[model samples]
Target: MCTYLHGPRQGGMYYFRRGIPAPLRSIIGKREFLISLGVKDREQAKRMIPQYTTETQAILDAAASHGPDTAPSPMRAAADFALWQNKQEAAEYQYQHSMEQEEAAIAREPLVSALEQKLKLSVDKLSPEEQAAKDIIDNLKFELKLSQEKRMPERAGGERPENSSNAKGQLKQSGAAGPVSSAQTSISAMYEGYATQPGLREATVRQFRSIINHLINFLGHDIANQVSSDDLIRWRQFLQKEAAVKGKPRSAQTINNSYLAAASVTFDYGFNERLIPKNPVALVGKVRAEKKIRLRSPDFTKAERKAILSASLSIDAGRRSAQLVGALRWVPWLCAYTGARVNEMTQLRREDITKIDDVWAVEITPVAGDVKTDEARLVPIHEHLIEQGFLEYIDACPEGPLFYDPDKSGVGLQRGQYKRVGMRLAEWVRGLGIGQVGDRSLQPNHAWRHTFKTICLEAGIEERAMDYMQGHASRGVGRTYGSNTLPMLQVQLAKFPRFELG
Candidate 1:
């Protein structure tokens, strides 16, 4: 007590003094802890001493509960929290055993006063019959008491405070319906805010949400400040090591995207909100994405294309919902000659395919829904496509989208949800063993784009013109003007070798 008092009698400051326990003195490598109270009066210092005493006792009691040795604060808090939980369970079973359902609904603090009046012991000292009050909230209350009593300083998770070796990290505010200690936004909360940005597509928003969820699951902590570069590193390793495409490790593209998503959510949002001091993932470099895709997905071969055409017309076209059959049937052919992506083919409206000038054309644009580029263009109706009854399919849907699942369609939903429409063809391809080239199978629907580029090059189509026709970003200054206009592109379509489907 005398050591805690220092300075001249005329003017002096009070300090906290606690000798390190013998067993932990060497490990702590400190003889004593001293912190200034910043006070000049003796009475205030006297009043503060009890709080420091109780906090130290709680820490030592936690150490004593586990064994006769002093341990660090996180370990001590863990042991104390465990003991508190056990005692609460015993007390609850003894006094409120019959109240389990109702008690569970009512938070523990809301019922604490009633429990205390009946049992009449401080929660820390567990009695035989009253031992059954092991609610987690009670543990939170005890932890909060220790933190407030000690006036603990800020530090990282699982880190010791500068003031005391036995001091744990700051206590978080209880999630219960009560007065919260402070305003702290969590990782999950940050994600909720990020999801609200306008102009983000449903698919793009979902990807960002998925990145945050991966990080949350990996670190097992939703608190933003607690996250560290180590956590990001482990998560990256997990995605690279555990994420797979057909039992093979994920491509560098997938891994790189995951890292990008995580950094955006954590550093971008967390830093802006001041929830974190700095972005924990800022220095975590992206995985070196492989330039060439290593996935086994391949383009449709000659024989495979022929078989698919046969199935669509013979078996599928005769089904009860012939309209759906038409979508599945012509979708591949539309992709074949036009070199358009699968979604573009499935999402086109009847109005989208109309005669422009003298040439009948397919208008690939955003009138139906969100286009990949949001930039509309015209692909002249290839003679092979029009010859395959495509005009008849458009006539069948004069007022609506040509391809859609009627079950999932609603007023708020986008045009046809062709995710399944695209998938069904991939499975059909897999069924025919068409997805494989050598030992590798083509990535379901995307292989068409690859096949289209290959065929265009083989057909001697102008190199730069292919980009514009396919909705790909154009290259070169002159290429930005595009190789030709809509009518001339019709000529290029005529050059494409036609495959008979009707």
Candidate 2:
């Protein structure tokens, strides 16, 4: 995103060029790095140079940091993949075989337990037949337990090892069992390892990857140990101030989130590995919230709801509207009825909407992507929603998100926030003049929860039941004894009065 062009050359058209650093020249196997901007006009070339410059710099940086032999060769990677496939097949076979054995053992347990109970009085005191039965049962249980332990395949050691040779090459590159991580590990190298760490959520890792990618471009082929606190400060400052000046400024929350993303993963990884003496991000301060971004509404006023519905339906209805996010049409109705999150509605597949014990419901869960509570729950589709051609919409596509394009179902930054499915929903709400509830602002697509809760509570539905419908955990003993069933939730949801958008 450099405004001024730094590298230039002439060919059939103008091209971007960079001379490889002298020390790294042999590793790159080239004197000068080059890429055509694919245009002749100065303005066109300038516009096109950023991408070409970015890509060429990336290639040069990789060569400088990792050289050519740091990672597994292509043939070696393919061989490792083959090994992994074989391991998977073997694991599948083991799993099925183990399951069969476990089933047989479980099926025999009832008879065994019964026989054992029958002989429990005393081996000698029991009848001869009962004693014999106990002996047989005891032996059967012991044999079953032992056989299971002996036959169960232990987990493969150390996650998908690259078919021995590739592993050896990697080991050789890392310096013959010197330590878990080499002293020379680059920032990029550290990120690759950290991203795969156990217990890190996939969603979180992705955020880290995004944050780290930005950091790398700033650091420029920096090694893990070479990055100083100053470097972190610059990166954080760049993200907080400079980067966004060119476009939309990242919110305080975005800045802080980016900070945490890097600190928790990249810096933490380097520190844990002893590659860096201290975490540079540990002292980084959180960005202050200078302005409010109400992502969720405290409550959608009846008037705001009407405006939203009117604007939504009035547009090129049901066609992906340019004025609003993909959900401008059906999302409001779904949110109003079910009280589900925007993503909860947007990420739903046709299969996600199915009858559970005769109650037609949408499974508002994390199957497609991350959910708020990380727990799946059932929200019965309102009769009003079904009546409004919602079922027809669902029927059209039997798979993928109901409110999003199928091809772009799983696409987006941090999970469909910036994909072709559409524009940001909050902006639409703001555009509709549905800005805030009292002091609080309405988050783009989040206010529906407030609306549903208010509506349902006023309509005689219990708060606890509403919580269940909205996928929020309920308090007290009710959660322990009371169940969250489709039929039960359907009744509470039915109490929600459907809106007349027209």
Candidate 3:
């Protein structure tokens, strides 16, 4: 005799087995056997036992109907089993739907492999939400096999209209084309217009060209009339994304400047040439950049000044010939005392210095036709510079620039040596373990100018007088007196105390 069991725990199926075994007694406890009948109450378990036994007996009778010697038909058995399983699954899903609508909404779509690849490409340039929508569309296409089933109507003899259909398709394609680009027109005008500014350095020109190129490439050929305010905004966002992807989002000031340069030039050209009715860039406002001031004082203290001077003189003769040391020592000291720019100091010649009423002054007016800002001014040599051996150094290099580059190759000292000297000085400072402020890695030669201003302010020198000494524009009486004369300027120069390193 065989024991029989049927319950929800057996997946709502009927089963029979001889399970009485001493070793397996713990495996199926009393509670499990009762629960297997789909009944928690003792009364319900007793009542369901007969019904379960009846179902199990029916399953056994059906199995017996298929003779032991007969082979089961695989196709018929599989189809019948699938139909029953699908119906059961549908019932289960219907029962669970009330509790899982939110979860179902978030479920992933079933997209074919090929459709997935194409959808990824199409939505690559869209935002996250748009990409999700595109994914759903791709899944629908795969589920329906829409593309494969799209067929044209058959002609009576199966002949197709070739030329006419091709012509219509071409016309449809041409009608959807984008706008044309204004690259050649705008860029050519910008380059030609600003080619003559005196202050336009080589570096500035390069930056201008770079900004124009970026705009042209991003906008493409049909960019002129097709571009709108929203397009510019999108372009800016794209630039930020590109920078972030490269691990360095450009500074806000840098982005603003680039945008201004490109947009302003293009729109201005368009407006002036009557290519457009008005300037598009005129709508954009200036980007307020953070103010950067080099307040880290480089002026040497009294002791450090002496040490540097001693180091200069004590340098191995083989390292920097004695003549070079003697020539360079007074240069750094003059820089600390007068605060003259390195370029101005390096370019100074003996003839540029003159004595007025026994007071020495340095003339810095542009020689002949070589003015930097197309304006010339005289700079007075400090009395401290004279005391620090400027007079002696002047006697040494009387004809040419005081700080001459021995390497007479390339662009020469006037342009390159100034930067080299600054770098060398920074290295020397670092070697001494003294902390430098504000970009310590690259010593700023311009710090001397700041030192000069600070010292002048500290000494209680009148603002106008100090401005005149520094060769800056002055106001009021100082402006009217306009002491362009050497003697009059000499009187004003006498007021500035000679600078001392200590």
Give lDDT for model 1.
Answer: 0.57
Could you estimate the TM-score for every candidate? 0.58, 0.54, 0.48
lDDT of 3 by residue, 268-351 (tens): 544334343223343233344466665445554445555554555444545863334544565556566555555455555568
Better of 1 and 2 by TM-score: 1
Q: Return the number of clashes found in candidate 2.
A: 4
Question: How does residue 248 of candidate 2 score in lDDT?
Answer: 52
- lDDT of model 2 at residue 396? 64
RMSD vs true structure, all candidates: 22.1, 24.5, 32.9
Q: In terms of TM-score, which candidate is strongest?
A: 1
CA lDDT, candidate 3, residue 436: 47
Candidate 3 — what's its lDDT?
0.45
Q: Could you tell me the lDDT of residue 29 within candidate 3? A: 13
Per-residue lDDT over 1-502 for candidate 1, one digit per residue giving the tens place of the 0 to 100 score: 4444443121245555566476643322234444455576677777766665655556545544454233334544332332222222222212211111211222232244456554555667756556665554467567655654453244344322112121222343222213321344577787777677665554445545656766765664566666665677777878788834445676555565444444554455554444554445533445665566455436777776677667666644544365467666788778777778777877776788888768998888877665667788887877866877778868877565677755444443332355445555656656766664344445545667777788888888876667778888654344565345777787776777776544
- Evaluation by TM-score, superior candidate among 2 and 3: 2
Ten contiguous residues minimizing lDDT sum, candidate 3: 159-168
Tell me the spans in candidate 1 whose CA falls farther than 4 Å from its real position: 1-183, 196-199, 241-249, 272-275, 288-297, 317-320, 407-416, 436-441, 482-484, 500-502
